[model samples]
Target: MKLYDVIVAGATGMVGRKMIQVLEERKFPVGKLFPMASSHSVGKRVVFNGKEWTVQELNEENIKNSHAKIALFSAGASVSRHFAPICAKYDITVIDNSSAWRMDPSIPLVVPEVNREKIFSGSKIIANPNCSTIQMVVVLKPLHDKYKIKRVVVSTYQSVTGAGQKGHDQLMKEWNEEEIQEMKFPHQISFNAIPHIDEFLDNGYTKEEMKMINETKKIMGDNSIQVSPTCVRIPTIGGHCESVNIEFEKPFELSDVREILSKAPGVVVQDKPLEKIYPMPIWAHDKDEAFVGRIRRDETVKNGLNLWIVSDNIRKGAATNAVQIAEEFIKGK
Candidate 1:
């Protein structure tokens, strides 16, 4: 058996830590695991596959020293912009979980369930789509293939944990006491929903929202498919929930829609409203598949349908998705 050396950048952060867990859960062929982080976190230890691996400081010199075959980077865009290309230069295929190269035409923004074909052996760096966009596209792919989707309007109820541990800590601060504090978020995240994620662009849409709009088109492999998005941060944890309304070029029966999603890979349908069984963050936390429910027809438009999608933003959204891309690459061999 051939085991590949794997390096995880930002190994101490929220997404980075989960990436290690997913790697073990899926039983990836790892020869040596390099857990890399910033200088402040260099000595910390992370448990993976029942062994504690010490974190290494990430830098151009140390990075160039490795012979790792695959690198999963969850560091911010700056780190990715500087080191990802360097890692690729070492012939390491990078699966980056950041907004860095998602919009770059040269890089393939991949959602394994939706566009595994975009990832190839020669592909240097693969971009993971935004957390909100991923779950929506997983559900959208099957419907789009069947109904020929025309347009999609999505409103995301994102968990605070999506902002990383600091956002979660800030929310906890407010929850533990009545006193409020300014956070990485522009406004309070506990007991309130902020209508912003990332910087607000001149077009009145935040960078996060635009990522959803454009990344959806790229992953779906159709620029003609329009997407409108409103990304909001809530005090919830575990997962992100999206209310998506889609219009298709062809009409689809409600039962067929349910059947399609139920059978789709990495998607589960939980649409029994009378029994009060629908997708929720609490249930979706730590789960791998995207939970989709609240399926119905939109009476206002032709060939319109609505869906509620939920998934652990850290799991399927980042760590699991990146690992799946690597799996697809391996399977292609």
Candidate 2:
């Protein structure tokens, strides 16, 4: 098997850690793995594939000197904005898990199962959509192909884990009978839901909410498809759930929708409402497949459908998607 050199920036982050795990789990043809972090994590050891790999501090010089041909970046957007170009300059193809370049016309904002054919080996940078956007778009792509999605109104029950390790810590701290720590979220996360995920914009939509709207359009390749989103930070640990109402340009049968979703790559349809079978974060946790359920026609509107979608935010949303992009790059070679 051929091997490729790779680097994972933000290796200490929740999504970054999972990126490494996915690389190992999928056994991507990695010859060398450079684990990168901020200065604070320099020299720290991270165990991968049962071996201790020392973490290296991310600096422009190190990034330029590294022989990594592919780099998966999950550091915040600022870090990505500052360093991603530097890596790109050295001919490294970056699969970024941040919103930094998703909107860039030059960058291919990709979800492997949806727009993967757009990916090319010559593509220097690829943007992974938001976790909420990733699963919803995966479930929507097949339906859109069959019925032509006209618009989407989605309400996300996003997990605290979407916020990162700090979000997870906040929930655990609250769950452990401790006083509220105002770190991960603005309000109490345990036994409560916060309507806000990211900073609020003038339009009253949080950054997280807007990402869903914009990223969905980009991923689905349908700028005419309008998306209104309500992103909430829920207390769940692993998965994110979405209540999506879609209006199709063409009519769709409920049974046909379920069959299409069941056959869609990276999707698992679990709609058996009679037996209380539906997608839940608890059941979807740690899984790579997006779970869709509650397939029903919206009685209020013509050519309208409603569905419930769930997926492990950290896996399919972040790590696995990035890994899939890497796999796409490998296959191209």
Candidate 3:
């Protein structure tokens, strides 16, 4: 068996670091691990495959020479836009975690459980779906396949980690009696939930909301499906939670819905409300699978189902999803 040479771009950041961690956790065969980052992050120590490694500076020459078969990119859009194509020139499969190229008509935005078939052996650039979109689609895909989904109304209670390390640090500063002046979000997020995630657009929806609506349609391969999302930021440091209401074309029974989700791949149904056994962010931290509960029939309309979904924003949302794309690609090869 030949080991694959893998490079994790932006290797010092939260998601990039987690990608390296997940690759080791999944025991992915790696011939060499090239941890790529900016010059400022260069020489930082990174542990992988049970050995200490140093981060390398990301540049045209560095990327071309790495000879990496796969590159996991979690750097922001500006970095990804510049470096991902350089990696592609070397014939590396770049699975990008940023919002960059997600809506590109030529690029396939993928959720492994829902649309792994979009990945082809020749694909050089693959876009991982948004953190919120990933978990919803994991649950929605199963229901959609069964009853034909018509619309989705989602309000995300996202963790501070979704804003990356800066957001997490800001929350901690406020929590530990420090004055937070300038940070990622517009306001402090210690105990209060801000009803905003990204910049607000003219349409009164945040860019985060638009990403959910548009990405959901693209990843699900259905433009006819309607999505309305409100993304919020909370002080939690681990997982993101969502309250989702779905409407289907066909009627569904609550029991049948639970049965369907229970058997779905990459989905864990935790709907025992009476036993105090429902999914929560604290329990979902560091967990890979999407945890779903609060399943019930929407009373106002026929063929409507309500659900609560939770998962680690950094793990399954970003790093794990990117690595899963690479894993499926390797499996097909």
Best prediction by TM-score: 3
lDDT minimum window of 10 residues, candidate 1: 177-186
lDDT of 3 by residue, 104-195 (tens): 98888988899988987355999988999999999999889889999999999999999998898898888788877677888878879899
List the candidate 2 regions with Cα displacement exceeding 4 Å.
Answer: 179-182
Each prediction's whole-model lDDT (CA): 0.91, 0.90, 0.91
What TM-score, computed on C-alpha atoms, does each candidate reach?
Answer: 0.97, 0.97, 0.98
lDDT minimum window of 10 residues, candidate 2: 177-186
TM-score head-to-head 2 vs 3, winner: 3
lDDT per residue (tens digit) for residues 61-149 in model 2? 88877788999999989999998998989888999999899999889999989998768725688988889999999999998888898
The residue-by-residue lDDT of candidate 1 on 76-169, one tens digit each, is 9999998999999988899999999999989999998888888972669999888888988999999999989999999999999999988888
**Candidate 1 pairs with clashing backbones:** none
Candidate 3 deviant stretches above 4 angstroms? none
Total backbone clashes of candidate 3, pairs 3 or more residues apart or in separate chains: 0
Local error of candidate 3 at 244, Å? 0.4
